[model samples]
Target: MTTLVYLETHDGELTNGGLGLLSKAASLGGGDVAGVVLGSGVRDAAASAGAFGASTVYVVEDEALAAPLPQPRVDALEAVVKESGAENVFLPASVLAADVAAGLAARLDAGLNWDLTDLRLEDGELVGLRPALGDTVLVDVGWTSTPRLALVRSGTFDPVESGGTAEVKEVAASFQEFSTQARLVDHLQEESSGPSIEDADVIVAGGRGLGGPDGFSICEELAAALGGAVAATRAVVDAGWYPYAAQVGQTGKTVSPRLYIALGISGAIQHKVGMQGSGTIVAVNKDPNAPIFDFADLGVVGDLTQIAPKLTELLRARK
Candidate 1:
């Protein structure tokens, strides 16, 4: 089975999530794993794909594809799929990649399995593991036909560099008139301190138990002491206690940090499903019987208002 992993780049750097998916696909050892990159001036990022395990990298670089839009990428990816004759197409879940994957599925009339957390070769067939019943059960999903499309959940896999090289081939652009109609007007970036949750090794997340918007300062202080980032649950984001960009839950971004510090979080299923992949989970709550205590590697029964500041001070003193 020939696999094609969509490699998405931002600011000339390959996104870690896409690279992780590419690495996972290559690990299957089923057949040749190729990568498809589409963006203007992205030639430099193709080599990084090889380091993650792509045997070949197909690039479609053009001025029209420079913007982070979906239509142009969909057109470019469809062309590569046909040229490479890829039986399986995989993409890391992103706001833009999701649209591109959906467009490709419609263009090729292929089955699309989305929100997959894992994939494996079972009995010579590709099986995708997806969460069902509100993430209570893991269901095995498969495509009935060739040219299967899958959108893997973010932070599902870690990219392992093998120091390998890839054969880079530039594919010709085949853009339709309508595909290039939409153009990016302006991009507004959210201002935040410290590392982003996606890249942070440690994340300190707060929930409704934080009391109010001011309570986030406790999380921020702890995150700063740890040289990490601050995250929040959907409840706080919807309540305007935190920015949506920092929200961590089923409706928000998935993060797999080395250490996850949850303060005042009840560990509802929606929030647990997102951070369950963390290496070590530590929860600080006043309730000893909080649901988070059931899964957290370390549970501290206390009021975060008193505990968080002290923890931050201890970390600072150690430094």
Candidate 2:
């Protein structure tokens, strides 16, 4: 079998999630694993995929792909899939990736398995593990047709370097008329200090219990002191107390930090699925029966307003 891993890039660098997926495809080991990079000025980023375990890197550099759009990418990916004769295609979940995967599936009339958390080879066939029934259980999923497409959940795998190199093959870019019609007008980057939640080793998340937007000051201070990042639950984001980019839950981003501190969070199943992969979980809530306490490694039944300030003070003092 031949597997094609889509290596998504941003600002001329490969995304950790995409690289991690590439490493996973290589580890499966039953067949040759290749990576396909689609973007303008992405040759350097494509070359780096070899270190993460892509034996072959297909590059399609075109001005049409300069902006992170799905349709043009779908066109490029389809061309590469046909050229490579790949039986399987894998992509990490992202706004652009999700769109591209859906478009590719529709264009190729192939089967797609999405929101997958894990994948393994069984009897020389690929099987994906998808969370079902509110993420309480994992169900096995597979495609009955060839060129199986899968979109995995973010942060499900970590990139491992193999100190190898890939054979770079450039492919000509071609796009359907409808795909090239949409054009990017302006791009604005979010201004943030410190590590992003996805890359942070520690994350301090706030929820509805924080009272309001200002209540996140304690979380910010604690995250700053711990050299981490600040996150928020879906409820907090929906209330406009925090930016949607910082939200963590079923509708938000998935993260697997080394340490996760939940303040005022009630630990709804929607929120738990996003951060359950953290190495160490700690919760501080006044309610003793809060669901977060059930899974937290260290649960403190107390008021977060008081506890969080003291914890931040202690952490800063240690520095």
Candidate 3:
């Protein structure tokens, strides 16, 4: 049996969300774990799979994968499906991954489970757990079939060691069809100024209560003082208060930074599913009963609007 996790990139760099999904795949994956790599650095991305618990890394290098389009990933992942006797397939819960997982399922004559919050092996069968109705309730996976496809919400899981020497295998995966209709538009890569949130030792994340885009500056000030990166919850991302790149939650990125600071977030289950794994958690929210406080190691009930500037000033004075 094969347990495969499809990976994506952020700013052309490998995404930690994919790595975290692979970590979950390692546990549910009964046999060989295949990490399907697509895009520019297909060959070089093998090391990262090992770190996330994939022993066999399958690489498919093609320019089409440069963008996170469903067709390319669908084409590439199908190639892996054909070659490996994989009974299960996993992908991260991003716009691209979700599209591809569903499309791949249709193409492979299989079934798919999207945004799974939990996974387990039951009576020798793969089990999937996910939230329905905006996470107010969880539903057991309804689909069960050969090569079961699961879309894992980012930040909901921890991966184990893929458990051996990394095996690099290159395959012939193509997304040629898409190239015909799609124009080769020019693309520009953004250079991250400091340690990316994924790479940061500490992260200060703000939510809706920060008020708006302006609120992040307070987080920026604190993050800068602590030499960390600034992140945001989905509410902030959905509110357009911050760039989609900086969002952290079920639908956003996954980070295992040393410290994760949440300001004004109420800690929705979907949001908590993502960052609960951080080593240290500190929350600043006005509502004392906010769910974020439940998972937070340290919780302070206060207004972020009032406290953020003060915190920033305090940090400035420290330096």
Q: In terms of TM-score, which candidate is strongest?
A: 2
TM-score of each: 0.97, 0.98, 0.82
Residue 224 of model 2: what lDDT?
94
lDDT by residue (tens digit), candidate 3, 1-319: 6788787765455577778778877766577777888776657765567777788888888777766567777888888888877788888777777788888888898988887877887776788898787667888885557878988776565545544666878888866565335554676676656688767889999998888898888888888888899988887788888888887766677677889988888999877766777999999999988988878999999988787778878878978
Q: Is candidate 1 or candidate 3 better by lDDT?
A: 1
Q: What global local distance difference test value does model 2 have?
A: 0.94
What ranges in model 2 sit over 4 Å off?
Answer: none
Pitting candidate 2 against candidate 3, the one with the higher lDDT is: 2
RMSD of 3: 3.2
Instruction: List ranges where model 1 is wrong by over 4 Å.
Output: none
Clashing pairs in 3: 23-159, 53-162, 87-147
lDDT of 2 at 303: 96
Taking the tens digit of each residue's C-alpha lDDT, what string does model 1 give over 1-319?
Answer: 7899998897789998999999999999999999999988999998779998999999999998988899989889988999899999999999899999999999999999999999999988999999988888999999999899999998788899988999999999789999989989998988787899999999999999999999999999999999999999999999999998888877788899999999999999989988988999999999998999999999999999999999999999999
TM-score-wise, the better of 1 and 3 is: 1
Q: What are the lDDT figures for the candidates, one per model?
A: 0.93, 0.94, 0.79
Error of 1 at 279 (Å): 2.1
For model 1, give the 10-residue run with minimal summed lDDT: 245-254
- Candidate 2 residue-wise lDDT, 1-319, digit = tens: 8999998887789999999999999999979999999999999889999999899999999999999989999999999999999999999999999999999999999999999999999999999999989888989999999899999998889999999999999999689999999989898899999999999999999999899999999999999999999999998898999999998977788999999999999999989999999999999999999999999999999999999999999987888
Better of 2 and 3 by TM-score: 2
